[model samples]
Target: MKRSWWKIACVVLLVYTVVGGLLLPVPALRQLQETIRNLYFHVCMWMAMMTVFTVSVVNSIKYLRQLDLRRDIQASEYATTGVVLGLLGYATGIIWASYTWADPNNPAYASFGSIVREPKLIGTAMALLIYFAYFVLRSSITDMDKKARVSAVYNIFAYAMLFPSIWIIPRLVPSLHPGQEGNPALNVNDVDARMRLVFYPAIIGWTLLAVWITSLNVRLAFIKEKNWLNAH
Candidate 1:
C-alpha cells in the first residue's frame, strides 16, 4: 500500500482529468472555442516535461556532489524520460495547432512555415537535441567512472543551456504561443474558474506519471550496470 499510494493517486487523478477535462465547460472565445479543452492534456505534457527535466538536473547536481554512479544513472534515465514526454507533448501540440491555431481562417495561424519558424518549436528542438547528445556522449566512453563524471558535468552544462534555449530565447522571438502578451488561456477572466481546478490537478498528475516512468527506467539501468560489473 505504501509503495502503491502515489501510483494509485496518479491513476485516479488522470482518470479525473480525462473525464472532467473533456466534459468540463470552458469559456468560449474567438479562435479557441472547444479546442480549449486541449489545454488540460497538451499543455500538461509540456509542463510535466519541464518538471521531469528539472528533477533530472537536480539528480545530475547530486551525482556531481557525491560522485555516485547510481545518481548519474538516475540523472540519465530521468532526462531520457523527460525527452520522451517532450516529444509526446510536441506531437500533441502539433495536432492541437492543426485543428485551431493552424486553421486557414485565422490570420495569425500558420500551418507550415510558421511552425518551422516558431521560436518555441525551434528552441524546444534544440533542447531535445542537446539531451540526445548526452546519451551519445555516454555511449562513446568506455570507462565507467569517466563516463559518469564527464556525463554528470556535461549534464549540468546541457541543462544550463536548456533553460536559455527553451525558455529565454523563445520569449525574445515572435511566437504565436500563449504568454507572449498575457495569455488569455491563463487569465482568470479568459478561463473559467472551474477549468483551473482540473488544470492544476492535470499538471500534477502528468508530472507524477512522468516520475513513475523514470523510476522504471532508472531501475532497469541499475540492474544492467550491476550485472555488467558482476560479469567483468
Candidate 2:
C-alpha cells in the first residue's frame, strides 16, 4: 500500500513516539514513569505555538519594513495559529498536572489548585491575553491601510511582551514546572534520554502542523479578498 507524504510522516512519528517511549526499561523511564507519555503531545503543542509565534513576529517585522498588507494578513494568520496551539498546550499541561499533581486522594498526586497557580501557567495566560487583544485592536479599525499599519506596530510590541511574560518572568519565580528560576523547560538536566527522543519530534510535528494550517488560512484569506474585490 502507498501513502501520501503527510500520512507517511504521521505514521512514522506516531510509531516513533509510541515505540521509543514504551520500549524503555522501567528503571530508565525517568521519575514521571508512564506519565511521561503526556510529553509527546504537551511538548509538541508548545513547540508548535513557539514556531507560529516566531513566524508571526517575522511577518510583523516585514510588514513594518515594507508597509505591505499581505504581510499583515500573514501575521494575523500566524498569530491565530499560535494562539490555538498555545491554548492546546495549556490544556495538555493542565491535564498532565491533574494526573501528576492533582487528586490528593492518590498519594502520588499533588494538589491541582497549587499546580494551576504556578508561575509558568499564569505567565502563559498573560501572554496569550496580550495577543488576544491584538485581534480586538485590528477589528476596531475601519480603514484598511490604518488597520494593517497599526497592527504591524502592535504586533512588534506584543511579540516583545511575549518573551518577557511567558519566558522570562515565569523563569524568574520559583514554580512547580520543570525548570527553575532563570532556566527553561528544555534546558533542565532532569529530563532523561527517553523523554528527549519523543519531546524533540513532538516539537517538529507540531510546528509542521501549525505551518500547514497557516498556509491553508492564508490561501483562504486571499480567495475571500479577491472575491470581495470583484464584487465591489
Candidate 3:
C-alpha cells in the first residue's frame, strides 16, 4: 500500500485536475478567457518534463561516477519520458496560442506566421531538437559502453541547454507569451488563488505520472539487458 500510494495519488489528482480545471472558476482575462484552463495541462506538462529531465541528468551523473549500465538505462528512459512530455506540452501550447493569439480579423496564415516567430516557441523547439539528437547519438553508437558513456555526457549538455532556451532566452526576447517578467503561474496577479488550487496539484500529478512511466520503462530495459546478457 505504501509503495502504491503515489500511483493512487496520481489518479486522484489527475481526476481532480480535470474536473476542477473544467468546473472551477477562473479569472476572466482578455484574449485568454476560458482557454486559461489550459494552465492545468499545458503548464503542468512542461513542469513534468523538467522534473523527469532533472532525474535523467542526475542518473546520468551517477552513471559517470559508478559506471553502472543500469544507471545508463535509467537515464535514457527518463530522458525518453521527458521528450514525450515536452512534445505534449509543445502541442498544447500551440493549440492554446491559436485560440488566444490569433486575431479573428487577420488571415490564418498571418496568425501562423506570428506564432511561428515567437521566441518562446523557437527556443523550446531548439531545446527539444537538441534532446532528439541525444537519442540519435545513442542509437548510432554500436558499442554498449561507448554509447552509454557518450550519451551520458551528451545528456548533461542537453539539460544545460534547457534553461537558456526555454527559460532565459525566451524571457530576454520580446514575446507575447505570459510570465516574461517572472514566474507565470506563481504570480498571484496573473493566476488567481482559486486557480492555484488546481494548478499546483496538477503539476504534482503530471510529474508523478511521468516518474511512474519512466520507472516501468527502466524495469523493462533492465529485463531486456539481462536477457541479452544471458543469451550471449
Candidate that would win on lDDT: 3
Candidate 2 ranges with C-alpha deviation above 4 Å:
1-11, 18-31, 106-112, 182-185, 227-232
RMSD of 1: 3.0
Clash tally, candidates in order: 0, 1, 0
Query: Model 1: per-residue lDDT, tens digit, 49-118?
Result: 7778788889888988887788888888988988998899898888788876675775644458777677
Location of the lowest summed lDDT over 10 successive residues in candidate 3: 164-173
**Model 2 per-residue lDDT tens digits across residues 1-232:** 3535774575677677667656754333454657767777787777678778889989989988987677888999999998998899888887788666666575433465567678877766776887899899999998877898888888888778767676566656667677655444477475666567676766666677788789889988978777543453
Off by over 4 Å in 1: 103-110, 181-190, 228-232
For model 1, where is the 10-residue window of minimal lDDT? 181-190
Top of the candidates by TM-score: 3
Q: Which should have the higher TM-score, number 2 or number 3?
A: 3
- lDDT of each residue in 161-228, candidate 3, tens digit only: 66766666765677788887755676678778999999999999999999999999988888889965
Candidate 2: 10-residue stretch with minimal lDDT: 24-33
CA RMSD, predictions in order: 3.0, 4.0, 2.0
